[model samples]
Target: MEIAEILDFTVPLSSITLERVVLAILVAIIGWIVVKVLTSTFTTALSRASNLPGLVVEFLARFFSVLLYVILALIVLAALGVDISSMVLGLSAVIGLILGFGLQDSINNLAAGVWLAAFRPIDKDEFVEVKGISGKVVSVGILATELLKPDNTYITIPNSLVWGNPVINSSRMETRRVEVKVGVAYDSDLDTAIRVATDLAAAHEKVLPSPKPAVVVTELGDSSVVLALRAWTKTSDVGGVQGDLNRGILRAFREAGIEIPFPQLDVHLTGAE
Candidate 1:
């Protein structure tokens, strides 16, 4: 009924009493407030970090949340007059054992995850060729990396593999060169063939102006003369430009009477028929 009476109360530390109950309630309230503040602070900080990957940010926020709550729980237990040092040591030992043997792959993945998040070699929705696999990145997760292939196939590669392999980001550059190689019959005018290719490349809307597409005589094959037509275009327009140029070259060559050569053989009966 009185403040003095509440303070003067006496009971075993292990046993619940009015004073202990009141202290425990206060401890719980304060711990809850601390948890809320810590969780919010950590989440806000992580969200504002521009360099961290999305998944890593989320993982770190959640990890800190779990870790903070665990700390608060230990504080609450201490307030209840329970010693937690031994418990902590024992828990640490168990975790160490688990990590040392049973969870090696998980640890490797976690390490790789950190590297992926930090370096950011590849990003979501970008086309990449890594470890002989080509696809658009879907998500880079803590344990695995996901990719969506051109055919709509989904691939899940472990983070360790993703990080270890060389990554080629096709979309990273603004422009890419598209090369079209064609061969003409030996009898066809090489100058005429080169003019047609260079003209088509220069006239294409998607091809870049500064590079100035070039037609080079690459080789003299047994059946035909090979010409290499190389042009630069925006990365996004590469496929379209390649297809259009192929079709256009075929039509142009036909109209110009420049024969696109095919292999043929003439055999004469000398000793046997």
Candidate 2:
């Protein structure tokens, strides 16, 4: 049996000459290059000319690339003397069935992607927490959203899950509040402790002056007086400022002779039964 007979091609085996094979190879190469150039140009044009969100622009570029490649494939098949009309119809039917059943989750993800792109809840480079995962948004694609975690790991979440869950955007605000809780001995002077904490926060360069760093007595515990130090700083400086405050407060408390209390247990025993 000939090659054509195995694949049920309408074209006869004799027609599958070396020249046709070379032509097919040449067409594929050229088509691939053309597709690359077209997609690149289309992406650049959309980015420059339109106000669409970056994710939406990416989605459009991918869609256009897929469409062009499909067309290129059909042209290549035609060059091979294959009947394309029936093949296209058959492919359409198969695709329809796949979309209807096998790709339901994919369809939902795509829809969620569209919603995400349109609403602009999260954008590239923004720090966010969604579904208990915290990371910086890398790219939002048609099916999934990519995130770059703080520890240099990458995570990909399906758009459906991302859309269904609440998103916490930490980078949306210009500044963030940093709170550090400290406990002092019950016998320590509360006024002096508060003053030391307030001074420590105010001395930090990152801490905002307008809000004014404050130390408030939060709780009277079993072994200590709990005080909370609150300060505001630029969002990007939150971690650094918080660390500095913690270290500074510890050192300052020691120097000021204020005691940081720890939990203790007191027991009484009867001498006689």
Candidate 3:
């Protein structure tokens, strides 16, 4: 009930002197500063010295920071004249209990993160589709993966989900194929349409020259003949190349008098009932 009685009951004030308490506080402050500086330096050195992926470097930096803080806690406890051996045992028991009861998902995320870092399926700044969400990978953290969508939205996916799902990495390959499908009227000259499409693709600056561009008759629908124009370009230029090819083909088709057909339904009236 009394303040002194409460203090005595809560902490062993008789055994710990004012000087020891002050020393512990100072040690904690100094250790925290040292830990921060050491962590930053280690992160910089590791990033510059090793050729590890950015996600792996980030994960290592975070793990090192946590390890430093743990050591700092032990040092502070030692300065306070606390028995660290027993404290460590007690802490281990507490951690075990937490893992067994409340941290199963957290543990899985951590393991998944480690696997993601080790295997390098996806990395920072790469465009990927995971679990039906498509975006550029911003970071792979201990618990989750962050992505930046095209609309500038930020999304966080649990590492467990990311690891469990198939990751479609668009930026992994250097070259990508761009295909544009166009339908021409049945009366249109198929050879001329194909040549026009191929020419448009070949004229695009981003399109690769080695494989060359080609046009193939994909399908003969009820109303039109579908032609597919396929070209190879650098992965980064795929969108631009596709757009350019589409626009160029449309314009060239008009100049060449090729008519692109639209869906139409034919109906006949029954005179006799």
For model 2, residues 24-125, the per-residue Cα lDDT tens digits are: 889999999999999999999999999987767887787789899999999888877778999999999999999988999999998998898888889888
In model 1, residue pairs whose N, Cα or C atoms come closer than 3 Å (at least 3 residues apart or on different chains), thus clashing, are none
Candidate 3's C-alpha runs over 4 A off are: 1-16, 267-272
Q: What TM-score, computed on C-alpha atoms, does each candidate reach?
A: 0.70, 0.84, 0.88
Clashing pairs in 2: none
Note the Cα lDDT for every prediction shown.
0.84, 0.90, 0.89
Candidate 2 C-alpha error for residue 34, in Å: 1.5
Range of the 10 consecutive residues with the lowest summed lDDT in candidate 3: 5-14
Error of 1 at 35 (Å): 10
Candidate 1 on 1-273: residue-level lDDT in tens?
A: 798687557665546456666787798899889888988888788778666666567656656777788888888777766669888899899999998889888888878977887777887678998898899988776678889999999999888988888899998789999999999999999999999999999999999997999999889888889998999999999999999999999999999999997977778878865
Candidate 2: how many backbone clashes?
0
Candidate 3 to truth, TM = 0.88
Deviation in angstroms for 219 in model 1? 3.8
Model 1, poorest ten-residue lDDT window?
A: 8-17
Winner by lDDT: 2
